[model samples]
Target: MANIPYREVLGSLMWLQVATRPDLSFAVNMLSRFANNPGRAHWEAMKHTLAYVKSTTHYGITYCHDSNIKPLGYVDADYAGDTDRRRSTEGHIFFVAGGPVSWASKRQDTVALSTVESEYMAFSRAVQQGIWITSFMDEIGLPQDTPVLIYADNNGAIANTQNYKNHRRTKHIDIRYHFVKERTANGDIVFEYIPSSDNLADILTKPLARDAVIRCCVGIGLRDVEAGGVL
Candidate 1:
């Protein structure tokens, strides 16, 4: 493992994730953390990601020509998923015309006491990006409708956005995370609940089974180009 070029391999994976591979975002993000002191297990995981990429070389995002499809966002979080720091991982993806336009997978800055806090934190970050996407669309003559819709699988987090009253469980949360509540109130964005089974952003928050991976890939417009319209 000492001889392995972990950082270089990670950089290549990072470029792939940023360029056209939303499915690899979480895996690459996780592996990048051990760059400075990677073990044999980390090296094996890096190899796995490379092999997966090789097998899916023909897969790419496919934009369907449907004008009715408008911009929408999905956000999710895995609470205390970082074993080293007890930090949560937040992930989100925004789509327009049936294809992802932007997406991210990042670790939370603070330790969340509950799953709801982790989710709400993720919501705040997604809203910031969501608002930017809406503004950019408007400037490009593709003005999106007001109150951009963002979907989350956590019912508690959705309720937190609507309920301004801070209780014992939530009062300790950072002031910045509360921005999601204000945005909901001022019509900048709206939070809606979706079943976890259907939340495409789930792939970006944690490691998943192969079946789930394919489902999310298809959901977000990634296609098996060599097979002509399959994921």
Candidate 2:
């Protein structure tokens, strides 16, 4: 681990993640967490990621022009998934023209008290991104006529956010995360539930099985250029 160029290789993957591979964001972000003091296991995980990229080199996002320009979003969180810090991992993806345009995966800065809290935090983060993207779209003369739709897998979190009165249970959460509540009140972003199985952000929230990863990858618009057409 000490001898391997972990930082350099991770940087390369990060560039790919930002440019075209939204599916790689989670693995890249997770690997980047250990860039400073990578263990042997971490190095091995990096090698696995590289192997994945090599196998899916033909896969990439395909954007079609027939669809509207407004962004569709999904967000999810893995409850207390970080082994070292007990922090949840937040993940989100935004799509426009029927293909993923922006995505992120990262360890949360604060530890959540419950699964609902983690989902709420992740929802708030996704709202912030959605708001920013809305503004950007307006600037480009493609203003959204309706509220941005954000899908989440947690029904409780959706209900909690739509509740104007902060229950005693949720009073402990930081006031900053209430941004989602305010935005929702103004109809800037609408939250709806998608089954966990259909939530594309699930792939970004945790290390999934290979089949699951490929499924999410395709869901996000990655397709192979090979003749087989099966990834």
Candidate 3:
């Protein structure tokens, strides 16, 4: 592990994710946690990511003039995804002009006792990104409609945002996560329920099968220049 260039490879992957590879966000974010002490398994995972990158060099986000300019967001979370700490992984992506403008995949700072709680935390993160996206759009003279549409797969979390009632199942969740509820109430953002199978943000919260990955890639407007079509 000491001899391997783990940090160097991670650095390169990080740049790729930040610049042109929203599809690699989850993999790179997960592997980066082991930069200080990567083992054989981590190295193997890094190699797999590198191989995927190599295979999809022609893949890039495609934006069309007819695409929707209004920013939309998708958010999801994997409950107890972290093997070492049992923390949830929250992921989000914002789209403009049919292409991803920003996205993120990160483990939650606190352990969530329920899937709903984790989803709520993910909602909070997505709302923060939505606020920023709307602000930028306004500055560029593309002001968005009120109550920015944000999609979530969890009905429980969506209900939480709509209802102010405190229940035992969610009362224990941190006050910070309730920021999403405030945003929803104020019409700054809205959480609409989407089916898990159709949620694009699912790709960012966990490792996916090949078909699911390809579907998500296409959903995010990733296209292959060589193939001249969505990937």
Candidate 4:
């Protein structure tokens, strides 16, 4: 089947995402959804994605022990981004030692009715992942300080988690998704607003210009190591 090549292509992209290109994780994940019966257009898009990767093959996340910055996270969601189902995509990045250690891009299971709901869902997933990372770090004796910061561009979503008075609009959200509020109340994490320009997670959720992509990659500490540096 012609579609078989599409699956292999997507699988290759996924391997890149998991290995060195966390920046491509979300886009690859989104495109992989259409691999079952890819048309010519989809194949073209896949080629373009591959070309982009080839152009920036040197980029990668680097974790250096020299930096003292505390571990932090950034999260954002693209509201109703999927043209077919109007579903949102969630993107997040976790940084330690001034570099990204973990990140993800995934489509929301449920279609969000509003931008706030989409952002809330994204934040919820980020919180869950944050908890898991915190636990794992603790197990490794690298526990982070309290109030791990999570940045979001959506003010309404932050308000929803920080305050309980907006239930009129959010009452429809599932109880499981409301766990972000609990984490906020317990002081395990704090949600703050970050201007879109500074949201590193944007690279995961959308196609950006080459300059923006390079800037984000640098912010995540992906760089070319010199001969003097550790190999």
Top-TM-score structure, candidate number: 3
Query: In model 4, where is the ten-residue run with the lowest total lDDT?
Result: 222-231
- Which whole-number lDDT from 0 to 100 does residue 211 have in model 3? 98
Q: Which stretches of candidate 4 lie over 4 Å from their true place?
A: 1-4, 226-231
lDDT of 2 at 11: 91
Tens-digit per-residue lDDT, 1-231, candidate 3: 778999999999999999989999999989999998899999999999999999999999888889889888999999999999999999999998889999999999989999999999888888988999999989989898978899999998888898887778877675755677788888999888899999999999999999999999999989987888646
Residues 1-231 of candidate 4 have per-residue lDDT tens digits of: 453488888998999898778778777977888877788888888889999888766565677779854668899888888989999988999888888778999988988889889889888888888887787888898887878888989988888887756466677775744688889999888998999999999988888898898778877677755432222
Candidate 1 TM-score versus the reference: 0.96
Backbone clashes for every candidate come to: 0, 0, 0, 0
Cα TM-score per model: 0.96, 0.95, 0.97, 0.92
How do the residues 20-88 of candidate 1 rate in per-residue lDDT, one tens digit apiece? 999999999899889889999999999999999999999999888964456799999999999999999
Name every residue pair that clashes in candidate 3.
none
lDDT for every model? Answer: 0.91, 0.88, 0.91, 0.82
Cα RMSD of all models vs. native, in order, equals 1.2, 1.6, 1.1, 2.4
Cα lDDT tens digits for candidate 2, 70-89:
88999999999988889999
Decide which is better by TM-score, 1 or 2: 1
Backbone clashes (count) for model 2? 0
